[model samples]
Structure formats: structure tokens, C-alpha cells
Target: MAGLTKDTPYPTEIKLHQKSRILDITFSDGKTFQFPCEFLRVYSPSAEVSGHGPGQEVLQTGKKMVSIVKIEPVGNYAIQLNFTDGHNTGLYSWDLLYNFGLNQDKMWQRYLQRMDEAGASREPASRASTAQHSCK
Candidate 1:
């Protein structure tokens, strides 16, 4: 997959709410998105989170109370998130962020389906499995 570059127009602001576990981002082009902590947790772009193959993806569940503790810049292409629940590996690229911003609904639905298949609940705050994987 292609990552973003310095010229890539990223969001102007990215606010993390510790109490509500929400990541509110406002793009420079006037688009605003409020991605929930659970949403961001489930959609983490880290190789540990997203699998290498399409069907190899592991479902993330029980992250409703997870909060974003930090947003560190990774070069000019992505931002590394430090989740309150101790997940700090994901490197969210601008392109991936934009795509997630656009396909939130569909992706969320798919996540729910995957959770159901895994007999998981979305209400708790459990640590996602650390079976190393990639999303390429």
C-alpha cells in the first residue's frame, strides 16, 4: 500500500478526549470526524493489529473505554498513537486516516461482524491479542 508524504494534506487538528475516549479530527479542507476510541482501536493500522492477508485479520473487541494518550508524528507520513490501554504501536498514515474517515460506517459494520464471529463483546476494555500480523 502507498503511504502519505509531506505534501499530503493532513488534518489541521487532532483532539483526544481522555474521558470520553474519542479522537476528534478536523481536516484542513473543512471535514470533521469524531472517531470513537473503540473505532480507532479496532481499526489500528499496526501490523500487530491488522493482518497480512484479507482473511487473516484478527477482530478487536472490548475497547469502548480506551483513550488516546498521545499522537506523535512519524516523519511526515503518519502519526503514532499511544492508547490509554497501552496500545502504542499503530502508525496511522494520512491516506489511511482519510480512507477510514470516509469509510467509517462500512468498516465499523465489518468490525461488528468480526466480533460477533469471534464471540466477543464490545462493551468491555480488554487487551487485544498480540499475535504479530501485518496488513499488506
Candidate 2:
């Protein structure tokens, strides 16, 4: 991942509200965004979710209740979010986070549309489904 650029908006404050499952972040540009945990998980920058190239993106399901358990800074440019669902690969950079904040509504709508088309549910899968997907 690339480091901060001269034009990147640096985050001034980052707070995770566990009860609300929201990540509240403020940038040096004086803009603040409150991101729901589910949104971040579904739109993760990790290759596992985003894939190595276009058209290979994996649709993340059963993450409606996922929350950030920990936020670890990766140098000065990004932060690694350790989620309750055991996802910790994505390195959320300042620019990416800012973009997510800016386009949250549109992105969320797209996600919902995709889910609807796939006949998927945001709710976590049941034990039977989990067992079906487990390794042999």
C-alpha cells in the first residue's frame, strides 16, 4: 500500500463507538465522518474482499453485526482494523477512508442493490449454512 501523499487528508481524530458500532473519524481538513461497522466490513480494501483485480471482488455477507475490535496504526498513512468477525487484513488509508466517507451513500446503495440481486441477506448465516461452508 502507498503511504500518505502531499494532498492526502490526514486524520486528526479517530474514535470507535463500540455500542453504536460506528467509527467516527475527523480529518485535518475539518471534515468528520461516522462510518458504521457493517459498511466498513462490506467495503473492505482487503484483497480477500476486494480481490486482486476488477470483476474478482467477493461479496461480503453475514457482516451486518461486525464491529471493529481494534484499530492499529500502520505507520503514518493507514490503520488496520481488527474486526469482531476476525477480519484484519485491510489497510484503510487516509485517502481511502476519506473517499469512503464521501461516497458512503452511493456505495451503500450499490452494495444493497448487489445483495438484492444475489438474493442475499445481511444477517449472519445460521449454523447449518456455516457447517455447509466449512472445510472438509
Candidate 3:
């Protein structure tokens, strides 16, 4: 993991803005990131989202309006984000969070591009289909 370095810093402040549907995170190194709920939801590190192996990433669709209902601290290394959509598997560690923050723009662009190519919308997925479905 290139994101992990000798001076890897943990989160100093984590704030969720309900009105804006954003999660703000500040690291001990003075770096800060503002992540949209949808971004976090779709980019979840869980197997449900990331899949069990490479080239098997389940492209997350329809999560624009998702919101974080709760934030559970996972020991002292990571935080478990509980989404209003009932997704709480992703454990966002300090290094992972920092990496996501650093690559936010590129990652989001890639996500949007992939969505467009697959004709996926940002709207929340319907209840009829919530299981493992891949677009790539």
C-alpha cells in the first residue's frame, strides 16, 4: 500500500454534515477531505462492494442520496460507517481513508465514467435487486 508510510497519521476529526450529506475528515498531518455519502457508499472496501478478488469489483450503482446514519469506531485503527441504506461492512482505516482522500478526484471521475459506460444512475437501487451484481 503506497498510502501507508512511516508517518501515517490517523484521523483527528471526523464530522458528518447531514444537510450536505458529506463526511469531513481531518488527519493529524493537517490534511482534510470532504467525502460525499454516495462516494463513500459506492467506494466501500467491503467484499460486497469491492468483491473478493481483483477484476471482480462489483460496481456500486444508485447511491446518490445515501447517508451515514452512524459511525462506529472499530477498535483504534479504523471506523465502521453505517449507511442509512443498511450497509455497514466497510471498515475505513486511517491509511485507507487517507488514500481515498488523496485519490478522491481521480477515483470519483473513474466512477462516473464507469457509471456512464454502464448506463447506471446515481439514484438509489430498488429493493427488488440488492444482491451481488457486477457491471464490469
Which is the leading candidate under TM-score?
Answer: 2
- Model 3 per-residue lDDT tens digits across residues 18-113: 989999999999999999998999999999999998878888877877899999998878999999889999999889999999999999999989
**Residue 134 deviation, candidate 2, in Å?**
27
lDDT per residue, candidate 2, 1-136, as tens digits? 4456897898999999999999999999999999999999999999999999988889998787789999999999899999999999999999999989899999989898887788777778764354333110
Task: Estimate TM-scores for all models.
Answer: 0.82, 0.89, 0.88
Error of 3 at 37 (Å): 0.8
lDDT tens string, model 1, 1-136? 5566665558889888777777888876678888887788888877778887677666776775577878899886678888877998888887888778889989988887777677676655333354222121
Overall lDDT per candidate, in order of appearance: 0.77, 0.88, 0.87
Leading candidate by lDDT: 2
Error of 1 at 62 (Å): 1.7
Rank by lDDT, highest first.
2, 3, 1
Query: What residue runs in model 2 are displaced by over 4 Å at the alpha carbon?
Result: 1-3, 127-136
Residue 135, candidate 3: Cα error in Å is: 20
Indicate the TM-score of model 2.
0.89
